[model samples]
Structures are given as structure tokens and as C-alpha cells.
Target chain A: MPSISLTLNGRSVSGEVETKTLLVDYIRENQKLTGTHVGCDTSQCGSCVVHVDGKSVKSCTMLAVQVDGSEVTTIEGLATGEELHPMQEAFRQNHGLQCGFCTPGMVMSAVDLVAGNPDISETEIREGLEGNICRCTGYHNIVKSVQAGAKAMGG
Target chain B: MQNFDYHKPNSVDEAVANMQASDDGKFLAGGMTMLPTMKQGLAAPEDLIDLHGIDGIAGVAEGADAIEIGAMTSHSVVASSALIQSDLPALAALAESIGDRQVRARGTLGGSISNNDPAADYPAALVALGATVKTNTREIPAEDFFVEMFETALAEDEIVTSVSFPLVEKAAYAKFPNPASRYAMVGVFVAKNADGVRVAVTGAGPSVFRASAMESALDGDFSSSALDGVAVSADDLNSDIHASPEYRAHLVGVMAKRAVDACG
Candidate 1:
């Protein structure tokens, strides 16, 4: 087991993990932050997305030790004590989710997308969310939520 | 995934030494493909040498006549680089079109080309641009780098350092991506330089290949119309559930034309 330390959410955290322990598994199991879902276990689904050093990455694809000394942000870190992140609020207002299984990853990925390009167009939004699959909504309201979320984030 | 001993080497030499010491060691780059392959039980190595700790292998530099991109440079970084966009917009566009947002954020040029996935987009760009792939040991021309599907000219311990792409008069890449996985069903990259015109096709065959017929036509006249009667043989093309060999053959011509039009 490798002893690794990283800034998870906002605070510094350290743990011993197996070499094959995925970042998502470490976060969900060791840290007990179950907000991040593992919808596909594979990298195709965006359900396991998290910010590693401010860049959105598929957590399921990265080893836990690989994130040592880096800052990691998950869906749980987005909200500030009851005040939902603007993207979360937008998802709520626009009904961006249905089953809610994919919301966390969707929101995290969307925040990074909007942060990268504040003035993202609809086509760009659709293309940016290519990694996220939503079988329920057909992405109609999800696109709407991201558009609204971008505006709320001062885009 | 099988449990393995992990080693983080701070230098390319150290990484190579660690790999040599292990019974079955694999160098881990971004791990976008390596990790997934491990999870699927396709590969099982006794030791994993992580190269992320190695510095000076993950940036981009502009040379006098060509642009040198470090092996660890992520697709997102390449796609968003202002220098690359200004000088080699075709490569930037090609980088942007790979996989998706998250995959692009983590996938690296070295890993993609090293794996040499037959359907990968980078091989087409490398072959068409006549880029030079630099390893820790030596430099290899792109034409000789990719040998076949899931194979490259890399030695077990050789690490790709950087790739140098010469600035061209014009270049563009067009791909018909598989809707489910976004892997190129048929991708074409065309480049015109002082040397001449080069056309490379991927996702349509066992390996990325040069389209000499289309290259000669475009060498005479660099235009989409020049590919009117040019055709790629379907004899060696890949046929899967996603696309037929004949369909992929047709797409090679169509995508090559699109790439030429995009260059203009």
C-alpha cells in the first residue's frame, strides 16, 4: 500500500491505498464521500468526473496515488453550506436531472466547461457534454441548465 | 485490476531503470488507456512505473522551423495552446476532436501514439505532417514509428520525449467518428509543404497508411476537386459492426477531400 496525501474538497487528507485503488474508489470509500457515482465503471460515462488540480478528469481512470500533492474537488465540495453552487441551482431550476444518478458528475463537468469558456454556445455545450450520457432527459433541460448556470456564474 | 507494485520515478533514466528491474513492468503515462486496459483484464503487469513525477517532459516549445511538443502534453493543453493554434491550427483542431472533454484533459500525445491504436487520430496527423518522434534514446520519423495496430517502434524501456512537427503551408484533418466511442471510423489528414503533399488515413485500415494516389493528385493540384476520381482500395480496410470495409474505403476518400477543403 502507498501512503498518499492530497487536498480533497478543501482540507488536506491522507490515506493508505492499494496500488490499483482508483481515485473515485478512494474518494467514495476511504473518504466516505459517496456523492460521486460510478455509473459506468468505464471512462465513457462522465459520472465519475472530479477536479484534479482544477482540471476535470475521469476519476475512475486515475489511480489514487497519482493524485498525491494535488488539489481534488468533488461534487460534495461545490456547495457552500446549504448555498448550492450556481450550477447546482441552475440544474434545480431547469430540471437538469431526472434519476439524479448522473447529476453530480454532470454538475462538476459542467462547472469546468463553463469555467474554461464562460461564453460557451449551445453547440459547444452539447459537444462539451459528450462524455456525459443522460438516458433520461435527452439533454434538453441539461443544456438549458448549463446555459442558465453559465449566466449565474457571471459568464 | 490486478494488484501491482507502483514506482514513481523522478527522471526518465530512473523510470527506465525501474522498468528494467521489474519482472514485468509497464510505464504509466496519463493512464487513460493503460488503466482502462488493466481494468478490462487485457494486460497484467507486475510493476507500474508512473512517469508523472518526471519533470521537463510536459510542455511545448516553438523551434525555428517546427513546433516541439513534449510527450506528456495533454490533448486539452495542445488544443488550447495559443502558439499551436496560431502556427499549427490543424493539429490543434485534431487534438480538440479527440475523445471528449475529460479524456482530452488527461490523454497525452505520447500515450496515444505509443499505443498506436489503429483508429487513433494522432498517427494520421503525424504521418501526414512528416513529424519526428523523439525518444529518450533517438529520433524516429513518424512513418516508421507506427508499425501496426496497438504497436509502435518503441522499445520496452524507450520513452518518447517529444514530437517535432514542421510548419507546413497548409494542413487539416477530418474524421468520421464512431457515434458510440468517438474513435475515428475513418480519419484523414492532409498536409502541403515545400516538400510536397502528404495524405494519411486512419481508422480505415490495420494501420495508418499514406494515400499515394490522392497525394499525387493533390501534389499536382491542391484542391478538393483533384480527388474526384482518386480512390482507396478496400482490400486491407477494417470492417466492424460500426462500418463496413467498403464504407470505410469510401470515407477515406470523402474525409481526405474534406481535409483538403479545410486546409484551404
Candidate 2:
């Protein structure tokens, strides 16, 4: 087992895991953060999306041991006490979700997108959310959510 | 995924040493391709050398007439880089169109080129832009770096340090990406430099290749109309469920024309 330590959400976390243990598995199983979803075995689904060093990355595509001394933010970390993140609030207000299985990842990815490119347009929001998929909403609401979220993020 | 001893080397020399020490070792980049392949049981290396620990290994540098991108640099970094967007917008566009945002955030240049997937977009841009792939030991021209599908000229223990891209007078890339995977069904990268016009085609062949006919025609006239009658042979092109060799061959010409038009 490889001993690894990284900042999760806003706090420091440490764990000993197998070398092949994916960051998603470590988050869900070891840390007991089950909000990050694993939608597909092939990693095509963005349901495992998380912020690694403040950049959006698929948690399933990374090994926990690889990020020994890095910062990671999962879906579980989005809310502060009673209030949800702006992106999360936008998704709820705009009905950006369908079954809610992909909501956690969608919100996480959306927040990162807004942070990186706050002036993102509808086309960019659609394109930016290419990694994330929402089969039910057809992405119309999702697009609005991202646009609104960008505004809420102050840009 | 199999149990492997993971080594995070602090430097390129240490990485090389760790690679040479292991019986079956593999260098891990962003794990975009490697992790999926590992999950599918396609590869089971006894050791995985994580290269992200090495300091000063991930960044882009601007020079007089060329841009050097470190191997660990991710697709998103290249796509969002101001230097690349200003000097080589075509390369930035190519990187932006790779995989998806999540994949872009994790996939690295060295990993993509080192694997040399036939459908990969970077190989085409590299070959067309006349870039040089620098390894720890030596530098290899992009023309000779790619050998075949999933193969490159990199030595067993040698690691790709960075890719130095020489700025071209005019360049553009256009690809017909698969709607599902975004892997290019056929991608063309057209670049006109001081040397001449180079037309590199990917996804259509076993590896990225130059279109001499299109290059010559474009050399005569740098316009989409210049490629009007140029015929790309289907003889050596790839045929799969996505498209036929004949279709890919035809798309090669079509994409080349679009690429040329995009340059303007």
C-alpha cells in the first residue's frame, strides 16, 4: 500500500491505499465521500469529475497515489453548511438535472468551467460540458444553468 | 488493474533509472489513456513510474521562432495557453478538440505522442508543423517519431522531455471527429512553412502521414480549390466500423481542403 496525503475540499486528508486505487474509489470508499458518482466503466461519463489542483479532472482517470501531495475537491465539498455552491444553486433553479445521478459531477464540472471561463456563452457551456452528459434534460436547462452560474460567479 | 509498485521519481534521471530497474515498467502521465487501458486488462506493467513528481516538468516556453511544451503539460493547458492561442492557434484548436474537457485536463502531450494512437490529433499537428520531439537522450523529428499504430521511435527507457514546435507562416487543422468518442474519423493538419507546404493526415491511415499530392497542389496554390482534383488513395488507409478506407481516403481530401480554408 502507498501512503498518500492530500487536501480534500478544504481540509487535509491522508490514507493508505493500493497503488491502483483510483481517486474516485478512495474518495467514496475510504473517505466515505459517496457524492462522486461512477457512471461508466469506460470513464466516458463525467460522473466522476472532481477538481484536482483547482482544475476539473475525472476522478476515475486518476490514481489516488499519483496525487500524494495535491489538493482535490469532490462533489461532497460543494456545500457550505446550509447553502449550496452557486453552480449547485443554479442547477437547482434551472432544473439542470434529470435523475440526479449525474448532478454531483455536473455541478462540480460546471463550477470549474465558470471559474476558468466566466464569460462562457451558451455554445461554450454546451461544448464545455461535453465531458458531462445529462440524458434526460437534453442539456437546455443545463446550458441555462451554466450561463446563470457564470453570472452568479461574478462574470 | 493489477498491483504494481508505483515510483514517483523526483527527476528525469531518477525516472529513467526506475524504468531501467523494473522488469516491466511503464511511465504514467495523466493516466487518461493508460488508466482506461489498465482497467480493460490491456496492459499490466509490474511497475508504474509516475512522472508528475519531477519539478519543472510541466509548462510551456515561448522562444524566438518556436514554442517548447513540456511533456507533462496537459491538453487543457495547451488549449488555454495564451502563447499558443496567439502564436499557434491551430495547435491550440487541435488540443481543444481532443477527447473532452475532463480528458483534456488530465491527458498529457508526451503520453499522447508516445502512444501514437493512429487516431490521435497531436501526431498530425506535430508532423504538419514540422515539430521536433525532444527526448531525454536525443531529439527526433516529428516526421520519423511516429512509426505505426501505438508505436513511436522513443527508446525503451528514454522519456520524451518536450516537443518544440516551430512557428509556421500559416497553419490550420480540421477533423471529422466521431460523434461519440470524439476520436477523429479523419483529421488533416495543413501547414505552410519556409521549407514548403506539409499536409499531415491522421485517423485515415495506420499512423499520421503526409499527403504529398495535396502538399504539392497547395504549394502551387494555397487554397481549398487547389485540392479540388487531388486524389487520396484508399490503398493504405484504415477501414473500421466508423468508416471505410475509401470514405476515409475521400475524407482526407475533404478535410485537407477545409484545413486549408481554415488557414485563411
Task: Name the candidate that leads on DockQ.
Answer: 2
- What's the TM-score of chain B for every model shown? 0.99, 0.99
Candidate 2 has what TM-score? 0.98
Worst 10-residue lDDT window for candidate 2 chain A reads A110-119
lDDT of 1 by residue, B1-264 (tens): 899999999999999999889889998888888999898889889999988889999888999789999999999999999999999999999999999999999899998899999999999999999999999999999999999988899999999989999999999999999988999999999999998999999999999999999999999999999999898999999999999999999999999999999998
RMSD of each: 0.8, 1.2
Cα displacement (angstroms), candidate 1, residue A17, comes to 0.7
Question: Model 1, stretches more than 4 Å misplaced?
Answer: none
Q: Compared with the true structure, what per-residue lDDT tens digits does model 1 show for residues A32-98?
A: 9999989885699999999999988999999998999999999999999999999999999999999
Worst 10 residues of 1 chain A by lDDT: A112-121
Best by the TM-score measure: 1
| Candidate 2 pairs with clashing backbones | none
Off by over 4 Å in 2: none
